[model samples]
Target chain A: MHELPILRSIVGVALRHAVEAGASRVLAVDVKVGELRGLDAAWIQSYFDFVTEGTPAAGASLRLKESKALFRCRSCGATFPPGPHAGGDVACPHCSSKHVELASGNELLIESIDVV
Target chain B: MAEIRTIDIKEAVLSENAGLADRLRRRLMESGTFLLDVMSSPGAGKTTLLLETIHRLRERGIRTAVIEGDIESTVDAEKMAAAGVKAVQLRTGGACHLDAAMIEAALHELAPGDYDMIAIENVGNLVCPAEFDTGAHRRTMLLSVPEGHDKALKYPLMFTVVDCLVVSKTDYLPGSDFDLAALRAEARRLNPTLTVFEVSARTGDGMQGWCDWVADGIRGVADARDGALDC
Candidate 1:
């Protein structure tokens, strides 16, 4: 699955940053995933553990934070979060305009690495 | 417990791949080649549609090439080559999608500057390919009539990421409950700027519009190159 490859990248980034910071061990990797990505954190963590074995980040925990989808209206120029069923209908709440663009909510970032 | 020090590394997980894709896109623009990534579920007529589209493009004196991404077989590549265009096959073995690095390697093999357009038939999966950027100038995907219109709801990311949506297999829409209007509405909700075409590659219906859109892209790349040359 894609999670394995992405987790491998996470582990690689974490270890590299850890080593550069002169840390002896990595404690955890903090990542931010947007809602649109729909990635399961537990699934990614399992893959992270599998790939990080015998590395400095072998036992490091993965901390994933999900960000909600945000849309910016083209007409009213207002940004707002999607409704209850975000995927189904995403219109501007302020102007009720359908001409809205996805401003964020498709992010997959490694924010930081906790090392000691 | 040892003192924990936080190392701030605000980097994207696929930053390396994204960086390579950006560089490859710039290189393609400089070389006057329009790269198109074609994605869809298996058996959605990507090969059929591409063959026909390439034929039309060649008829208009636009050179075309193909890079096929399959999980294992080289069947599609062979077919493209038989149609009289240079085709390269990238067998991913077990991987589900093609990344930027693979495209970069394939470009070296393709010597892509010789062609006006290079289309990548990405591995037939809706999910993974949507996440990876393969340096394509435009990403178009097919949703065959048999796949149902609700597919846009099921695979939202795929719908959102694509530049164009081609509803293939219209020949099968006779008795099927595949609602084209509903699919368009749902897909546009996700991506309002998406260009959509309903075509049946089997009967050659709606193929001209699709080909024209692609030709426009190829001509745009050539125009950009000319503009750069003038500078």
Candidate 2:
């Protein structure tokens, strides 16, 4: 339900390119969503089917690849993933610095599209 | 039969929104307006905080206007009027968040140059509100004591995206189990650049500091404009 707007964006991007390419139909759309984005592939696919009806991306499949979050320690310059911490309870393994910074993994992007 | 083809387009799914937000920012900055998008869950004292901030800013002779975004009803806008401020309500009708387009419309309605500072009170939602950008210079997220400290952990995206984390309802801290240090620690770890503030609308405990921040933002923009004109 929360993915509708994002799904619309995905469909818009795919169809725009597919139409520019003069493609009759879109086969699939591959997206890279970060874990923090909180969008599931299956749910978006089900939503994609309804939102893409009668468009170039009609019946197109939705593919999603999730990215993991990366964190960098601010005090020690150590980089690590969040380990069993809510609000970062653990310290950096390299230097025991608790001051960690999020490096990545909050991406919600479309990587490619399959058109036919 | 048309031959099958593969297209390589690695575009951000929300590029359109991002682009519009950038353009809006440029527009606001050029017009000498400072915009802040305020967000939080329902009952997190957003309106209460806004009322206090606006009243205090007015007392200091700072011109401020508001854009109230809600699912429905103009109750919040009415409250703004009670504070003797100008506010244009953007009723989402049911949308959980206010996007750039909605803000664009509201800005025009408010008209530029009338108010140097503008605050957009986004729909009371912790999730979807963080996803959309309302073309503000900074995004503020409010976390009340009743909301719990673990919110920074349960809702990482919202907490991570905000520029300032305002802990509202601090007047109730004595009765609640909220830990300011632990919560700020996690929030800072998520985004080291984030600024934290503790405030209570009912008691006006930290409103002065929050108001100062707002005033500083407006003054910074105004000073730059003055410098540009001088040259």
Candidate 3:
């Protein structure tokens, strides 16, 4: 997972934001990560705690919101949400076509950080 | 009592790495250099295939250099040096992937004027290497037949991000239960524009196609810079 580096950046960004806001401590970080991004939210929280130790972001919890991806069927020209059984092996449900394209949901963005 | 507030920052997770990569890419464009970032799992024949490509290109008057990334050894760099190319070794001491910062450091050590293309052989881990942008104009990956076709399905991110996927070790096609068609289909399903070549670096099978594809990337970079100057 790239979470170690990404979470470390998150901590840095959170602390910077907290300082800019004149807050004494950071409480939580809200992030929007894609469903297919392959990051473990629980692991990110644990790592964030460990990495942020001595910083303003110490003890801050990571609040993750999984953003689901959209798939477009290249065969039938249809767009749909990637269902539960979605992956390389998955086909378009509407047309049963294997030629599907990932339209969105590879994003990993920091929405906001709560600070006090 | 302290004032609590929520700061809206909406920045990308890998922005730090991507920012460095952008600088490197700009430098490469200005210098008319094409960098190929190659990634694969350990023992996917990345070294062998890359060495062979270096050899072939050298005979045709094209100078190529390498930046080899490993956990902690000079073995691969030694091999590249013996092959008579300018080489730089980046020993991460234990990191699984090579980030743009590492590339920036290595590029400083490497003589940019000495080569037309710099092919970076990233630390051999499919998962983590794909996540970091190493400032390459083109990104490619190798998946050996021995690794099995299910790899693309399992490691979808790797398959999704790569520009090309070389199905290596085609010489062992008879021994392994590798389904070529299914693997190609699966990879295509993930990334429609991914160019694939079934290659056997040991036997020199399918090397020409790989070379041509790489030449295209090099030429594209060269032509783009020239076109910009013309405009």
Candidate 4:
């Protein structure tokens, strides 16, 4: 999976950062993945385990925080969470208009790393 | 005895990929190739449309090559090559999408200055591909008639980021229950300036328009680069 390479790169960067910060071993790595990002946490963890082998973060734990999809209605000017539906139809709770634009939930970030 | 300290290193997992994509953007601009990245779901007829596009561009004497991204196998690349164009396949092993670094690597393997246009056919995934920019000058997303018209709303990012929307499989419009008006409305709602095209790659209906757009984009790139050289 492309996630294997991408996760490898992420862990490499994190390990470098941890070592630079005077950490002997990274205890944990916290990452935030958005609901719409379509990243599988289990796969990412498995890839992390493979990539972190022989490094200071070899046995480090991975913590994933998934964010839910949220949207902002342009016509109603109201922000609401995305409903579990296939179509992009989101009735504005305020104006009942179905013209909503996504606001968040596409985030992919390494929130924090516990090292030393 | 060990000292345990919890450190906060808030960084993006895609930071490296983003950096590599930026590098690719610079390289593509410098190489004077107008890159068009296309994305859609499996069986959306992306390859079929691309074949027709390549044929039309070749007829007009435009040098073009394709970088095909797929989870596995080089079937699409082989198809492109058979259609008389340079095609490179970047296998993602099992990844759902392509990234900048992979494209950068593929670019190094190919002759960069040999083509005027480079079409990067991203993996058949609507969500992840939209998040990663692969140094394309323009992004295009295809939504076939059978795929339903609600795609724009369901995957807003993909629709919003694309400069053009190709409503493929127009021939099936009569038999299929696709709401053409709703699809156009939703796409325009997400991207007000998106150019929409309705075509059947099999019938060659809208190939000319797509070809003309590519020509214009290539000329624009050439003109800008020549002007910079003169300066």
Candidate 5:
């Protein structure tokens, strides 16, 4: 949970990777975060800002791609997006069955980092 | 002056974290310590299980240390220390998960040769921990009875990455109307390779299995390191 230390390390690794990949300055870093992972995008961006200091990634923009939690019904093989309604439980829109398996929305992938 | 040249460099943001994780893994292997990452939702008995595990391990003379990750506060670390274990708190300041670099820094604060095992208790979030690998030899996800059975399906990635699935708070089974079999079936379906254990840190139920697995993992790591050294 040490955001600064971890983010600093991540930035360091990312900058190193970028340099090794023939990059000078990173323009942007795109990351995907899933809802179930419970990550706050704003917080991550802030942390990125703090950690990227003095690194090749300094001043680089952090773009977060948020994925929603979706559930696939196991009984009817129906896939549906999670309801926007409040509360955590969501009933299947297709079969109206509670036997749903969650799909997507808990992703943390460094999709792409734009560099020059 | 009119012309300008620009270069396009597309890289992965997590490449750096992944690289560090790989290095940490190698170092852990070399040091004969098997790292275990524990993750779950907030108040899902992560600290309780950790406390009990640390106590049990100490009783058996297995030297262990903990890296407690939280968004803020050293309460968990304090609790672990009170139980007679060397524990350090790594405050995220609000980040959802623990990454390799934070763990690497924490390692510098501890005596490397003092402990035979290391447990990184990640921030109590299922999502980010799944994405960021902290170079642990094994990852374990805890699901408490109050959290419900749909967690595995809801948080598939967390379930998928973990080497073991611990269903904590077994003693509260009578109070909560949880479908244990269904949860197990769903978890197995998602991750067939996952080793499932039911534990109640409060009552000390089904903890032996958990401890045994830990011992076995440590022994396996030690044996591998010894074999490599012998070679």
Candidate 6:
């Protein structure tokens, strides 16, 4: 549902960079998305294609790199993937402490753009 | 022909909106107004809960305003205005969530200086709204009894981002199989610092604590501003 708006921003970023770099056209937009974001990469690509029409990024391919959600244990200072904690209890793998902080996973960024 | 080249932009997709949201937060704080963003799935009793909260805040003499975000219709905003509090309705058309620019426009109409606090009822969604920052001082979400305990697992991002969680519609808890403990545990796992409140706007169960929390937030902002002025 929100893919359009999200793609709009992504295309905006890619185009801005391409124009700033004096590129005539954008070839591809690389995005780093966290698993926790739950965004469908295919949906984003379809919307990107629609919104970027008639723009410098019209034919750009959207390449998404997904990152896993990791939790950092406050007690042990160890970061581990959330996959290991599928038991409903997200305890630290190193120290088994319940006191853990989400270190990363909510990322949504335009990593780079291939242009000419 | 120009050769293909890769440019490392390394920019967050929502950076522009985030920058605007941060600036809005600063501007609201400087005006001594605290903004709270309330989010939840539809029919989670956000409006009812907020109506009760508004009544309680009024009793405490805390001037408050509301910004209602909906995909369509002004029904919620009208209800808020009927309660005698200043209200603004943002129609997002087909957008799933409200972003900083929308909130900033609403605040312009609100003249937030007159209010101690402003509460924004975000569009009913468990996903998209969590992705956008609305420049609110705090973010809270409601999960009704019927929504089930599995929501934390199903929508972990929403549970992770919110500062507070209100388990609304507790009046139905008696006949339902809603496992409050499991929900709490799961939510806490996602967000250890999350504040949980079990409330039923209809029966008024646990409204005091929630209302008091809101009132305290309002006063805290006012007090902080006063302290800043004194310094």
- The top-ranked prediction according to DockQ is 6
Estimated TM-score for each candidate: 0.94, 0.92, 0.91, 0.77, 0.70, 0.94
Question: How is the predicted docking of candidate 1 categorized under the CAPRI scheme?
Answer: medium
Candidate 3, residues B96-201, lDDT tens digits: the string is: 8999999999999877766779999999888888778889999999999999988877787788789999999999999678988888777776676788998999
| DockQ of predictions, in order shown | 0.54, 0.53, 0.49, 0.34, 0.13, 0.60
Q: Per-model C-alpha lDDT, please?
A: 0.89, 0.85, 0.85, 0.81, 0.79, 0.88
Q: Pick the candidate with the highest TM-score.
A: 1
In model 1, the clashing pairs are none
Candidate 2 structure quality by residue, lDDT tens digits, B1-231? 767788999898778998999899878877788899999999999998988898888888888899999999999999989878899999998789999999999988877777889999999988998888878888999999988898877888897788898999998899788888888877866676788889998998988889888888888777766777788
True contacts kept of each: 0.64, 0.63, 0.61, 0.49, 0.13, 0.71
Ranked by DockQ from best down, the candidates are 6, 1, 2, 3, 4, 5
* Docking class of predicted structure 2: medium
Give stretches of model 5 more than 4 Å off.
A1-116, B1-13
| Alpha-carbon shift of residue B95 in model 6 (angstroms) | 2.0
> Chain B alone, model 3: TM-score?
0.96
Compare candidates 2 and 5 on TM-score and give the better one. Answer: 2
For model 4 the local lDDT of residue B217 reads 82
Q: What is the lDDT of residue B67 in candidate 5?
A: 98
DockQ of 3: 0.49
Q: Report the TM-score of candidate 2, chain B only.
A: 0.95
lDDT of 1 at B174: 96
Clashing pairs in 4: A1-B94, A1-B95, A2-B95
Looking at model 1, residue B122 earns an lDDT score of 98
